[model samples]
Target chain A: MKRGIAGSLESNDALITVKESDKLEITIKSVVYDFFHKQIEKTIRDTLSELGIDKISVVCEDKGALDFTVRARLITAVKRMEASK
Target chain B: MRRSLLFIPGNNPAMLRNSDVFESDAVIYDLEDAVSVTEKDAARELVSGFLNCAGALPMEVIVRINGLDTEYFSADLEAVVSDKIDSVMLPKASAAYLAELDFLLTEQEKKKGLKKRINVVPIVELASSVLQIDEIVKCPRVNGVLLGAEDLSGDIEVMRTKKGNEILYPRMKLAYACAAYKIDAIDTPFTDVNDGAGLEEDCRFVANLGFNAKAAIHPNQVPVINSIFVPAQKSIEWALRVQEAARQASLKGLGVFSLDGKMVDKPVILRAENIIKKARKYNLI
Candidate 1:
């Protein structure tokens, strides 16, 4: 696992800027490759669907998480996003 | 009306006594593949006693007897014929095997003084069984035909994949044959309990294919199976709307009516009515 900020997210009054802004930072504890990027995107999309949320920026902090762990973490991030909203 | 037919080992006293609580539409007390040779007699005794005591259980009870090749098959039939179980499952069956069992069961039903005919649910496990499904389904007293994935895979010499059923074509053929007979078609269980999403996907797939029920190997899978078979709320609501429109049209001397820009005929109306009937059973409406 590598310790570094791997992903970011930010939200505000405007949709595009909020999605584009990178205030929320994540330090992934491991080194993962582009092979996981598509799955991570799908996990984020599906988790958002289950949470009944849309139009939100998701930044994933990956510590070499497998599919199950990725889904769980994405769900946890969505819950945190909701609480912070 | 079983949406989930759970397989419980006949030798397990705890399973035999408490399986009904899982709310499965049917419970199959298994005496065949699940039981070893030494446990066959004990399993039969336990299952027979359980049937006599199963007065208040709401679900259908089925007994999976040993195959005819085994020595235990005769005794298994002898024990179950006198009992009031819903069906007797004939495992590893072909057309010839089903014919023999059909005759035996009919004679047993008469001799044992059971007013109702004992139903036979056959497991079409071998390639031979799949090839002869049409003739096999027409066998008298045959209730439902079920797929046995484990044995089928072994017979075909295919490696079991994560998708678990590479034998989908043969399985679907069996389902089609059952539908042609207007009898129930049951799918095999998903072996992995941790794969809840996979289970739901498979249930929806089987339901779409017109399988009447699925067999559950474990209790945890029961609730998911029940929910998948139960009509969705949106579907029920739509069916209700169609039913109401048709009823009003009938009062106005119209034999066919248009609902949501689609014409409703006898079959469409019947489908709506069935949805309401199933909803009423589930108390959804």
Candidate 2:
């Protein structure tokens, strides 16, 4: 019983991607994931849970994003993805 | 009217919104050289929305649009040029660009029913543009001309020396052009924001050269630039004493008088009047 769905963190030199879904819809946003990936990942995960969607994916387009920006953007993408779902 | 004009990247929404909080005479919403081509449309949309919602700030607001040669210039012009903003900053501008922008701005003003004229601030970023300073400054719609030191340095392939001795002639010519036409001349941004003392020295140098204002790349530089342009405390005191002497001389119907062993002529009186004006502006009077 996968209530919400899955979230994946994809890393790249210039960007990062996180995907989370309940198998209904998808949303994506890019952020500077520079060296702050850990904080950004946590923020995205927290936002997904808050949206009550267990399945989620977050994607980040990084140009060396700061920790706070990653978190802020991840939260935004999760909220947007969940609402569209 | 911008005592200090802050340059905010056209794409950054947070910075654009936060710019209003920085105490400056104006904030330049930059869309031209600061922004990459791919982000132009998005930046334009975001700034448009921000201008509509941002509360009336104490300073003037302007948008720096892409050059006429850029692919997004037309769209940038169409999206901006509303009555909400105070002026438009044209980068790498020529007299031709001035004509074109003024035409479009006039049309926009008519369509939007704006009461005030939308002024234009052109940047002399290229060698050719600098050479055409007289022609550019003479344009009616053009309010002022700014020296784009970074790009000019790159364009001419000269390394930017900190002292700025390399562009001395160009700066003098620009000052001359602005003075001849009675238009405001603005100095380029001082890249080193950490060097407050150096920045103040540069502001004084430019003010002495007759530049009306100087651009600031960071918020910390704003106060220094503004304070430097203002009359000095000692100078203010002298102006107050001179003004009082002149008032007393007027009571005696003496057009020329001496104050503290100094002969006060018309030019001296005028200088004192100018100082009084500056003092009044700062509430020092």
Candidate 1 TM-score over all chains jointly = 0.73
Provide the interface RMSD of candidate 2 in angstroms, 1 decimal place: 9.6
Q: Model 2: runs farther than 4 Å from truth? A: A1-85
Angstrom error at residue A35, model 1: 64
Compared to the true structure, candidate 2 yields what TM-score?
A: 0.77
lDDT of 1 by residue, B220-271 (tens): 9999998998788998999999888988998999989888899998999888
Off by over 4 Å in 1: A1-85
User: Candidates' lDDT values, in order?
Assistant: 0.74, 0.74
> True contacts preserved, each candidate?
0.00, 0.00
What tens-digit string does per-residue lDDT give for candidate 1 at A24-81?
A: 3222222443666566566556755776666555556554544434444344344434
lDDT of 2 by residue, B145-260 (tens): 88899999988899987688877877888999998887778889999989998898888888888786888888999989888777889999998899899899999999999888
Clashing residue pairs for model 1: A1-A29, A1-A30, A2-A29, A2-A30
